[model samples]
Structures are given as C-alpha cells and as structure tokens.
Target: MTDTITEFDSILEALHQAIEKSDSAAAIRTLQQADHDQTAKLIDRLSVEDRQALFGLLTPEQGAEVLERVYYFQGADIIEELSAQVAAPFVAELDSDDRADLMNELDQADSEAILEELDEDLAHETRRFMAYPDGTAGAIMYSEFVSFQADMTVEEILNDIQTNRKKYIEFGVQYAYVLGREHQLLGVLPVRNLLFASRSQQASEIMIPKPTTVHADDTIEQLEDIFEEHNYLGLPVINKDGCLIGIIDRESTTEALQEAATEDLLKFQGLMGKEELRSMPLKVRSGRRLSWLSINVVLNLISASVIAMHQDTLEAVIALAVFLPIISDMSGCSGNQAVAVSMRELSLELISPKEFRRVFFKESSVGLINGACLGLLIGSLAWLWKGNAMLGLVVGTALALNTTVAVCVGGLVPLALKACRQDPALASGPILTTVTDMCGFMLILGLASLCLPYLV
Candidate 1:
C-alpha cells in the first residue's frame, strides 16, 4: 500500500476505535474527518455480525445517519446477512425509499419479514415502489420528500420545515416540492432556494416554474437523457393524475443507469452483463455465452457455404484463390467503416430525413474512392506475383467494385433498419460481415471465371 492506502487504513483504525468505545458522537466526528469513499470502506470493513452491534452502540437516529452514509449495496448486504427476525426492526427504521431498495435485494422471506415490521403506511409505500419495473424512474425514486401547499407563505413553509427538519433529515430530504390542496405538483424548490426566499413570498412565487418531472413509467434511458439535458441533481416523479409520488435523486439515477447501460451494452455484444452474471454460477454464465457463440457459428457456416460454391473456380486459378481473402478483407473494412459512421450518426440523432440523401451519396462516393485505391494496390501485387496482367486486372477491378458495393450496402441497410423502427447498431457487425463476404466472393470469382481464358 502507498501513502493514500496507509492514510485510509489509519482512518479505519480510528473508526474501529470509536466503534469499540461505543462513542457515537466520535464515530460521526470520525466520518467528518474522512472522505465519502473512506467512510464507505470503514462501513464495509465491519462484518455483518458487527453491524447490529455497531448500530446498538448508536442512537436509532445516529444509526440512520451512518446507514445513509454507506454505499447502498453495502447496507443491503448487511441487512440480508442479519437474521430476518433481527433485521426486520432495523429495516423498519430505514427511510421509506432506502427501505424499498434494500428490501428488493433481500430474499423473499427477509423482505416479507421487513414488510411486516414496517408501519402500515410505510409498508404500502414501499410495496408501491417495489411494484415498479426495476429500470424505471418509479422504482428508483425516494418516497420521502418535503411537500407543502402552493398557496402557503414562505414563513409558513419555514415553520413547517422547522417542525419537520429532524424527520426530513432522517428521511434524506434533499429538495421540497410545492403542491396544490389536492396534492397536484406545482413546482419545486431546492432547500437552498427555500432558505433564501423572502418570508412573505408564497411557495408558488419562489418555486421554479415547469420543473422537469418524470412519469413513474419512464425508462432509465429516458431519465438519463433528461439528466444529461438539464444537468439535474434530482427530479420529481408523478402519477397519471399529476399527483406527486416521489423524487429520484442523482445517486439512484446514476446507479440505475450504470446498471441499465451495462446490460444494454452487453446485450449488444451478445454477452450477459456483470450485473446479471454476478450472482450466477460459472456453468450458467458459460451456457448463456455458448448460446450466442452458436449463433455466430451459424453465421460463419453461411459464409463458408459461399466459399464452397466457388471451389472449382478457385482450383482452376490458384492465383485467384490466393487473392480471394484480399478482396473479402477490403470489402469488410469498407463495410465496417460505413457501419461505424452510420451507427454514430443515428445514436446521436444527427441523421435526419432531410440529410439521408446527402449521407448516402457521401458514403457511396467514399466507398468508390476507397475501393478503387485498394483495388489498384492489390491488383498490382497480384500481377507482379502471378506474372499475369489479366489476372491482376480482374482481381483489381473486382476489389474496387465490391468495396463500393459493400460500403453502400453497409450504410443503406442500417439506415433502413432504423427507418423501420429497429436498432441500427444491430445491423453493423455480423450482418454487415455476411453481406461483405457474399459480395466479395461472388464478384471475385465471377470475374475470375470470365477472365480464365486470358490467364491460361
């Protein structure tokens, strides 16, 4: 370990001392001395057996503070490891939103035990969150937030905050929402804004207008887009009736999005992600990967069949056979170039109907130019090696033509797929390779057959 590691270890040692001494105030003070990651490490270093003991040393409220400071998964791990009977009361003590997230990761028996331990209203709210799809805003949002009538004066809101500050702090309230008498969302006010507002101002006067709101059903992808666009720390969630339901903070969104994106990326590459693979046995992981590999094998076989069809032509002109790989390779490169550009454009939404024709023409031009240059270079090599000018010319011409065709096909196919509501990126690798292989084989061999007499 280096200086940083040594420092962190010392901090952990200090924390352990505090824990052993049953100094709750000292532990909280120790937390202030270290950074967030250091605090997380201290929490993680304590075994599951030590969690309740550690908590028992602190007040219920101080335990809540420590729990909030640790990583969510680390807290969940401790909760899961505790006997359900022992853990239930602990779970009941968590803020509603944190409880929901922790419960979701627990075994069914433990989850049910915790639910039974919760007050009726908290249990119902926690169940509502668990019912949402895992990757949606609803599932990630915290039910605990500050809300007050829009008509209320700032002084009134201040009084309410003073009354509920301790409860809100324990609940992890980051921002307060403004709602109508019927609980319809009107706007949002960050705690800073609330603290700075004039006492005489109405909540509506101080609250931000038309604040970004998320529907309960919005996907993690949609939430990511919104967060990226607005650079938000948090956003509110509402039901169909426009009633405030919950608020999704940056932490939850970040966690959910990282998992969701990893899953999507792994799926695109034909693999199960770390998220899905983490809990799985090695045998199961292998089985999942093997299925995708089998599909790739089928694709390769199709390319092989195309090669098998031209065996006779290959045999007659061994020189041509030697150069076939060059043709296919050139075409494949050109196709991949087109696929990459198209995918990037589509993903960024840079490709539009108005620009479609321009993009197609540009890619086709690029294909033709690249194909001709590569063809000239390869044809020259074939002529020098084989001592047959016609053979070289045929290979060169075929390469040039096929490259152009491959690129055009590569660009067009993905765009067409996108227009038809399919993902364009999916059209790039395997499908593009297949098209390039077939075209290259047919073009080179077909040219070879036509030029056979001249070579002989």
Candidate 2:
C-alpha cells in the first residue's frame, strides 16, 4: 500500500482497537488527528451493527460531548445507523438546546421517528422549537427551567429542591419563574433570592413582577438588547397568549450576539447577510462577492468620470496631480474615522433626535480640527516639493474643504440612513471611500485649475 494509505489504515486500526478496549484517552488522541473519513470510520465502527448501541457504552455526558464534535450531518448519519431502541437514550442524553438543534437538522421522517422515541414532554418541546423559523429566539431557547406556583412558600420550594437536587441538571434552571394557577407567568425570582428567603415567605412576595420578557418571534438583535438592558443571565420567552414556552439563557444570548456582530461586520463591507455566507459553497461565495464588486466598479467609474473632467488642468500642472493623492488620502481617512464613531453610537442606541444637534456639532468640530491640521501638513509638503508657494496655498485650501466635506458625509450619511430605517454600518466601506474620493478630487483639482494662472 502507498504511504498515505498505510498511515490512514494504521490510524483507523489503532482508533478501533482503542475504542474496543474502552480507552477513552487513546480514542480522543486518534480522533484529534483523523480526517473526516477517519473520524466517520471510528463512529461507524462502533455503530456498525446498531448505532444506538454505541451510546450504551458511553456516559450520557460523554455521548453528548461526542455528538457535538461530529458534524451535524455525521451525527444524523450515526443516528440513522443506530436502531430505534438504541437511539432513545442517546437523544435523551442531549440537552434541550442541542436536541432542538439536531431535530431541526434532521429530515422530517427521521425527526418524527426520533421524536416518537423521546419522552412525550421532551418530544413536544423539541417539535415546538423546530416549528419556529431558524435563528429566532424561540428556536434557540431551552424549554427546561425552574418554575414555581405563585402561592408556594419559600420553604416548600426549598424542600422540593432538597427532594429533587438531581433534577437541576436536567431542567438547567438558573432562575425560577413564578406562575399563576393557569401557568401564566407572573414574575421572576432568582436562585439567590430563593436561597436567602425565609422558609415561610411565598414566591409571590419575593418575585419581581413585570420581569422583562421577549416574545418568541423577537429577532436575535432585539433579544441581545433585552439581555444587555436587564443584565439577565436569561430571559423568559413567552408566546402572544402569554404562555412561557422557553427561556433564552446567557449562553444562547452570547451566541446570538456573536452572530449579530458578524452580520453587522459583513454588512459594513457590503456582503450578503451572514446566513447566505455560512451555508453557501465557494463558487456561490465568489459569485455573490463578484456581484457586489461589479456594483462598486460602477461607483468607482463615477468617481473616475469626475477625475477625468479635471485631467486637462492636471496635465497642465503635473504638480497638482501629485498633490491629488495626499488630499484624497486625508479625506478618506477622516471620513472612515467618522463612520466608525457613528456606527458605535448607533449600535448602542446612544443617538436620538434629541441628541442630533449635539452629535452634529461634535462631529463638525472634529471635522474642522482634522481638516485644518491635514490641510496644513499636505499644503506645506506640496510647497516644499514643487517649490511653488501659490500651488501650496491653493492645494491647502482645497485639502481643508475636502476634508470637511468627507467628515460631514461620513457622519450625515449614516444618520440619514438610520433616519430612513436603514443600518448605519452599511454606510461604510466602498460607499464611504467612493464619496470621499469623488469629493476630494473635485475640490483639489478644481482649486488647482483656478489657481494655475497665479502659480505658473
């Protein structure tokens, strides 16, 4: 056999032997080095006769951890590879979130089969989440949480916890929700409060009513803001009928924040939404990127058209052409700075109509100060290089004007977009660069044309 095949086969053999010997550490090491095929081979080897049988040999936690490691598709393959009897405990071993995620990934037939194998309650909850559009808070929340009747005494709840101390692992309750007789959510009491409360105290007395909640349909961004605002470890997700369906915990919130941040970053660069990029093939990625690139090329052509109008002046005074880059550079840099600041403010919801006057003044002041310093530097450099004081003066004036324009465009455009219900970060990248270039080129060259007679 060739060296590559020999190495691969040897690794597979070693991995199989390790698993057969119940050598967890050795199996882990082998898996760490295995390619997709080899990794699948290991799972397939253990699951050859009956996939669910593999779960019987591993602890629930270990099985859950291993399932997470495999690609979602591979996990599904393993599930199908197992018989119905074996798949039951394996599915039960997964936490609510993981189970929901897996169910959503499975085909309807497989999902129904698996659901039938699960406990009735767990099966129903998983199906509930699978019903939500992917990425919404409902799809991501955990159905397991601590809930107490409104009239339950603190002592009663404490006694229950003592009786069912092991239940916490399965329910994964970080905080307890207070509910009325019909299971309508009334308030929330943190774990800390419950522990500190008098045994005689009722849950209703200690719980905070009107606790923050998000509807199941709330977007991830909305959920993120609620979490940040409330300083919550998790927030309850309720249906329109005011029924508590699930809870969005801190872990899910963090994941949502990461995905939201990624989307914003991609949108800032004018890319398609994150979902498009995540599941798309390389060729699809290229096609989407090329489409945007072509649009930007048209914008660039507009900028070039503006520059071409001033070419006669540029040729007559080659020094002006040399000075052009300096002005454009300053404007683009200053505009980008303003755009970044504006986006930060917008993201934090720190800006509003009431703050508009102050924000504009602040941005304008920054622009003026930036323009003055950059204008002086570029003007002095041009004078020294071309040995023409008049050329320097004209270039400096144009630099200052262009810089001011660039800063204003950067700030105002984002604000305008926000006012029209558009994302401000979308105002960055090619759009910002193109605007600054067109404005800078016009200001500098137009001034140079007017000042050419005086200078030469």
Clashes of each: 0, 1
Candidate 2 worst ten-residue window by lDDT: 272-281
What lDDT tens digits, residue by residue, belong to model 1 across residues 1-456? 599989888878877887778887777677778776777777767655556567666655655556667766667666766666566666766766677777887767878887887778878888988888777888888777888889899999988878887887755666788998889899988778888888999999988878889998887767878888887888899889989998887777888867655554665577732333233346857887887778788887887787788888788888777877878887988887887677656654677534667777988899889988998999999899988899889989989998998898777777777778765544356677777778788888888788778877
Please give the lDDT score for candidate 1: 0.77
lDDT of 1 at 120: 88
- lDDT string for model 2 (213-331, tens) is 88887767677777777777888988887878788887776776675577678777777533342333578578777777888889889889878998888888877777777788878
Q: Name the regions of candidate 1 deviating beyond 4 angstroms.
A: 1-141, 153-156, 170-174, 197-202, 212-231, 249-261, 273-280, 316-330, 333-366, 373-394, 401-428, 454-456
lDDT of each: 0.77, 0.75
- Would you estimate the TM-scores of all the predictions? 0.65, 0.67
Instruction: Give the total clashing residue pairs for model 1.
Output: 0
